[model samples]
Target: MGDGHSQVAQKDKYVAIIDQDKVTDEVRNIALRYDPLNRAGRREGFHVTENGELHIDDEAVIEEHKIVANRIPNDAIKIVRLPAERGELVHQYGENGFRLYELPAPVKGTVGLLGRNGIGKSTALRILGGTLKPNLGAVSDEPDWDTVIREFRGTAVQNYLEKLRDGGVSTAYKPQQVDRIPDRYDGTVRELLIVRDERNLRDKAIERLNLEHIADAFVDDISGGELQRVAIAATLVADVDAYLLDEPSSYLDVGQRLSVARTLEEFVEDKMVLVVDHDLVTLDVVSDDFHAFFGDPAGFGVVSRPLSARRGINQFLEGNLRDENVRIRDTPIDFLRPSARQEMDGIPILEFPALTKKFQSFSLGVESGTIFGKEILGIFGRNGLGKTTFAKLLAGALEPDEGRVDADINISYKPQYLDSSFDGTVVELFAGQVDVYTRAFETEIQQPFDLEPLFDLVVGELSGGELQRVSIALALARDADIYLLDEPSAYLDVEQRMSFAATLRQFVNRNGAPCLIIDHDLLLLDYVSDRAMVFEGESGVSGVGRSPQSVRKGINRFLKIVDVTFRKDPNTGRPRANKPGSQKDREQKASGNYYAV
Candidate 1:
């Protein structure tokens, strides 16, 4: 008992007892005594060092417990481990020479990065794209491959770097800011795609993405959804060994997103693909595996090792990293039941009578609909389907050619694409509404969306995700009877979208304010809506907005028209897009139960 070897013998005795399946309290206590480090971190296993030092088997936690790698290869490469940092910090603690994050290399199949806004998913993608060579804790200069490779050696990343260093891997990256696509290109969609057609897959990509109709449309004249598809097509048609797509699902409807994902899946068969996405359901379907980016937004990020898509998403939702033994969030996110069980009998808060609007290039017809108090109405359709037009009409931002919206109730509208004309900070945008900075609003909006740290940033300088959150929060802060949010889920990562959806739902229920949410992510709609309004018609030409119906009915009708079906996932109860021509798709279509659960 006096010597280390004697203590090791005592530990061995308990190990023998545990091995024999007699895990009594005394034996467990003995195991913990000799293996305190491992016991503290143990979820289901043990890590014993050569010198009989027992520690957590997790690479990230072990790395944290020890000194940073001094000589690169000689010390272990902290790969496949997630972060243990808290979600928010007043300032970035990693600016002076330390890494805000270290990510594991992507595996062969399609890999994904999942986290909230400002979490450095884009940064990780840039690193993988070879645009930003990692400094690897070197402050003065970007580390050369020799230094990088030596540090990354003994991991899959070492081989990736080797291939990159040798020019064996060619990368084509579709950036996150597709909104800027217009600034660089001044041509029709077809012209752009043709120019990017290095692989001669223009025709095939166009057909797969259903871009034939918009082929002749000008790049600058197109909507966000159109730009998103074109960006994907351009990236896909480029000949490359590695493909990096950031937020491919943004502005895409469920069907278009699935099509894009399917194409990427097919193309990745013999290639390396990395995707960063915010929609959990779409990310689940598109990615074979995922690496979670965890930490403060724009502060620092650490990526986890590759996990099966399902586990990665679930872990993100639970805010727990089993391997790293850390909880990034204070509470776990829970998926609601498949259906809304309670019926609202409250009086109508707002009603817009049948409305018709005519445009130079398009026309819209919106059927009369009523929103009851405490209701969340989801609007689902393809892009440019007049959903936004209808919301504008109701908000008095636009006038209907025919009927009129109720003038009694006040409406707060968050536009689909946020334009920052404001010359002040986010906090200033809410100067008159001081409650937004208060603790009461923090629990509902600021905290969940991680907006406090971003309060001082100029409105125009905010990132896409930050802008989207601020826009939604601003709309919510207004004293109005109803909130009209167009694509509120845009730019949000999986966690942010889930958190925002919960926040919106809570806001509506608690404040007795009805909300009309128009978004392309069917999963978000399903999660948030009490009823849904389906928009149908030709894109960029005309659209017909049907009256709001029960969430299930409206979604079913929309899915049926899109020729895709959704089934509830057994694990999470969230809607999942069935593969085209799969048995579920066929059965659901044949049974006339699209979106049936």
Candidate 2:
């Protein structure tokens, strides 16, 4: 009873609202069944393939029956769109079958992008920063900015692109992988940062980012944490209209992360900044709003509309977009409450007395502590506060000047720095010591760690995240009495990190082997640890490691040193840092309860 011009959908809701100028042929063709006009005229003898490619059985034969049986019902459009709400199409980019659906261009303040690795977060940032041109989902043809701006007419992003095209805007991008900066630029940190000082704020940048200690050090000789800060400082000194910072807090400890956040808050006085980070607590602190991403990793991504940082983080944790009426995940990711964790049931497996380690300029002293079997003890402090040194001492990789670990224990350690010098493949790397084909390894390490695809890849050819996964899996697979992981979550995506946490919890429960994790990510520590071993003292001068204690007390000890308080999200049980000077922060500090309910 209808013509081929329009189609009405739903019992009460009429959703035939596609504007002609905005729809690309590629996108339109993919959802052609939903278009009444296309549906009526598409009775030709052709078969639409799954990848939307057209194939002819024979050049001379035309069979209308071929099209009859190869049709997708119009209702499947719901599944194609998934969780992305159709509001406005600002930008589209595609490459190698991966598409960045809708991306929002920021004008002012900080906008945080949160999602899994290999999604379109970095691609979106590159496109917005003008480092990469968008193909409008049409990668076969050359990109045309006029067409792009025309298609986005009357939208907020249209004017932004026009400004960019006219050189009315400028951008500075801090890449996600700061470890590669040395390959691109070398020399002293001060020398490199001084040249990037478009605003002549070199010293100011160093002071603000806490790069004063490494200012004169060679870029290639500095630590990962130092490289991260130096990258931020380089961007900070640049005089640009917009700042795109990717993973600014990756290698930083909790104190350094908070300091970096405060620096970012001050730097965004009147400029726009877009940040991509996996640390939820730091992201929450630095961002005023968020653009939550939902998609299959490495396949495609769809970004939601602008949302308040609070609401965005909560909805992402809940795995649903209420406004879009879509489920991004099959189930919500829950953070276990302190009460939900298993009690400390038995005696400590590894015991150590007061120990001291002395370096040329820095020294560390530790009080007596014991790590309980089947319990995860989290080591926390600033970057240079001897967390890694302590782990090395415990693993017997380094000698202590004074006391020692009381009992002999077999230790399997994943160091803070991952070595990519192995000449053989990942399978060959673990060929003899551990079996990678066992059922236990499959469930605990292979599947959760996403290592199946990495079996054939040479160890030296792996990226940071891939190498981290391989290192973590190899360390966990070995037969040892204790597992010590240093910054194991580094370079992992949000989902990967969560999966690793869950796997560790399960591994401990099944094997009864304890893990001592040294990390800077407060959220990860809070999520995975049952006991806390807090390290405190002056950054490079001296460090003191307190005895292992309850998770609440350990968190409180570190939070007090950082001069902040955290409250668990009521819905997800995830810890969220309270804003400094906020009423909640003041209340927690007054009550001496730095880790609030």
Candidate 3:
């Protein structure tokens, strides 16, 4: 009896330890099941020893691993482990190559594929969708589209389809480029739904995405955020068993992003969804399982424990934030004046006069020269405000129905969708048209901005944050007297955003070049801008001018009013403050938090 009780206690202790480890034994089994070698060795349980030493054992517990691996035909498994060097060429770019290995069987429910940019996230999605083939990997049990349709044609087909259609595994894919929608679709929102056989699912998607008003507008004419939602709507209407979405929240506002998160919850209840995105914030809200891939010569590959399920997903998010490759920091441009009034009496670089654009129920004045050389002008507004529209008009891409735009000096505008403007390699842009600026800002652009290796890489293929950095580099390389940027730090992580703010300040100081930027990144706005214009009131959109000091006050007041929670550093219990430029000064002021406003 004593020996039996001891054995029971030991067993209970093992279970207790596994439970304390956070990930369950079931999850470990699932991960190991994908690799048959693990199962064959009887190494399938949560722990190798009683203490849980050699491995944490959580990798095997992924819920979808069992379902996906089970679905994969035996032929696919045979091909997955083929020699990497001998595989058929799947995709080839300058230094990037991709070869498909055996397709992992589709998982039972939604699955998320995560990784940094340049890791073939999109390429993998394409392979799964049958739009692209793997160069070196073998594909077995490839589902035939014609067979699916023909096999399910009649009553006889329905009976035969039971095994295939157990739960209806449909697929909807949203590409990375939001601007890639066909230029000639003459269908209304309702019409597009019908075309996609998603008319019934349209209302739910629309309500979740907040797209009731622009249902009838042309796809090309809507705002970037609206367009993204519409694309989601089109995908949702398909009611696929799984979804392949690439940066689905790229242009959405904060509120809209949260809404999309909720919608994803409803959409993926019993389906498999793979998403490729750089927005860690949005991904955190939606992901069930995480698979991270890193770029390599052969192809992008997965990281088993991308993040610890025990420590939770926040650690993974921080890892992404700290990755230097995806972060961008613009050189600080230092202007002579400390205030907006201290401008040199020269030709106004750019001007907006009585510029009013009205869509449905909103209007704003796109005012002029309030912007001067080397000055950082910050434009502030609410989510639905015309800040983005104002940026488009200033860039000369959108024609304002009510006002005229005049440029006294050369101007370069960085649109909100910075990726769309990039058509060539980074090196081509530097040496081709903007060579002189690159030579002038050689030290800053090369070292601080870090555009060296990216010179050979295609700009269109870069991640969102990476593209933003490239856009800043391209703009700084230009000789234009005035620079216009819209949400320059939208996609950047905390560190990159700080560096970008400093860089903008440095640039303003060196050349006294004028810059106007519209953004919701308040910390950046406060750090760089000498003057700010707050867009308030009804249709008139009054510009309440404020000094940097006063602007800080306004921001603090607004934050208090809104009750937004600021993130605190895990290492240091205090609220995380922006890094100070001078280490000595930062040390001196380390005792207290720097409160703006």
Give one clash count per candidate, in the order shown: 3, 0, 46
- Candidate 1 error regions (>4 Å): 1-104, 141-143, 266-269, 296-299, 318-331, 336-342, 432-450
**The 10-residue segment with the lowest total lDDT in model 1:** 9-18
Candidate with more favorable, higher lDDT: 1 or 2: 2
- 1 versus 3: better lDDT goes to: 1
- Model 1 whole-model lDDT (C-alpha atoms): 0.72
Clashes of 2: 0
Candidate lDDT values, in order: 0.72, 0.75, 0.52
**Global Cα lDDT for candidate 2:** 0.75
User: Which prediction has the highest TM-score against the true structure?
Assistant: 2
Encode model 2's per-residue lDDT on 343-408: one tens digit a residue: 777667887889999998899999997777888888888778788889889888889999977447
lDDT of 1 by residue, 1-597 (tens): 011111111110111101212223443334344343444675533333364433232222333232222222211222122332322111112212114345546677888778877666776666677776767545435557786666554667668878877878788989787887888899999999888899788998888888888899899988888899889999989888888888898898877877888888775677888888887767888888788877544334667767888887877778887765767787876654543533668888876788999999899998887889988888989877888888889899998999978777789889887877689888888775657656777776677666665677798888888888888988887788889998888887666777787787778778888888989877778777888899999888999999888888988898888898888777666566787899988999999999876
Q: Write the per-residue lDDT of candidate 3 for residues 1-597, one digit (tens) a residue.
A: 111111111110110112122234544444345444354585643234455422323223333333433444321111112121221123332111233222223454444555444445666676566565333321223445443323223332223234334434346787665655745465676567667755377777777877777777777666667777788778767766567888776666444665777787776676666666545445555666555443232333433222322122333333332322221113221211123333445445555566766654665565443456666777765455677677677666777777677645567787776654557877777677665344566776765676664666787677666787888867776777778887676556445666677787787778677888777655456666766765544322332223223454545443333233333335422222232244532542353323421
User: Clash pairs of candidate 1?
Assistant: 101-301, 118-297, 118-298
Ranking by lDDT: 2, 1, 3
User: Between prediction 2 and prediction 3, which has the larger TM-score?
Assistant: 2
